[model samples]
Target: MLLTLDLNDQRPLHEQVAGAIRRAIAEGSYAPGDRLPPARDLADALGINANTVLRALRELRDEGVLEFRRGRGVSVASLVEGRLAIVLRLRELLEEAGRYGYSREDLIEMLKELP
Candidate 1:
């Protein structure tokens, strides 16, 4: 998986990383049980601190999008539950956008502008 970070983005680096991974999971790029790059390796590739990547991964884990095993490292969570988790997250985002007076179109447009 390729994670690109934008330094100018108002979102924090950890959020960006987690968002990219979440998008990848939603798009079926990384299927259930697919192993993700190690935090250190991903950090090096993105030219950021390993802690940032770990923070992102931990967030995903908390959200049920990814799972980290003692010896197996991180992998996409179960397909059945992962999609459900993603859908719920999307719903939360939409509600948040609504609170900010952003329409569905506005949210889609913003997503389209992301790398």
Candidate 2:
């Protein structure tokens, strides 16, 4: 999968990385149990610090979308069996937006309203 990060954007680099990976997972680009690139390799490819990639992976892991192994590195979590994972992801995103002052109504109107 190809990932791109915009350094000029206001969002943190790690967030951009996490979001890209999340979107990829949600869209079935990265299947369950697929191993991700090493943090150092991904960092080099993205022209960012290795810690940034690590942070993104850690966040994904915390959100149950990825898992970290001692020797196997990070792999996508098994989420194909249920809708709970998707619901949890949406809750997390909305809660995160709330932290930045976005209300549910605002998000619904902006994101849910059809064009």
Give me the candidate number with maximum TM-score: 1
Which segments of model 1 are wrong by more than 4 Å?
80-115
State the local distance difference test value for candidate 2.
Answer: 0.83
Poorest lDDT segment (10 consecutive residues) of candidate 2: 79-88
Model 1 TM: 0.74
Q: Model 2, which residues run further than 4 Å from truth? A: 80-101, 104-115
Which residue pairs clash within candidate 2?
A: none
Could you give candidate 1's per-residue lDDT for residues 86-110 as a string of tens digits?
6658877997998899998999999
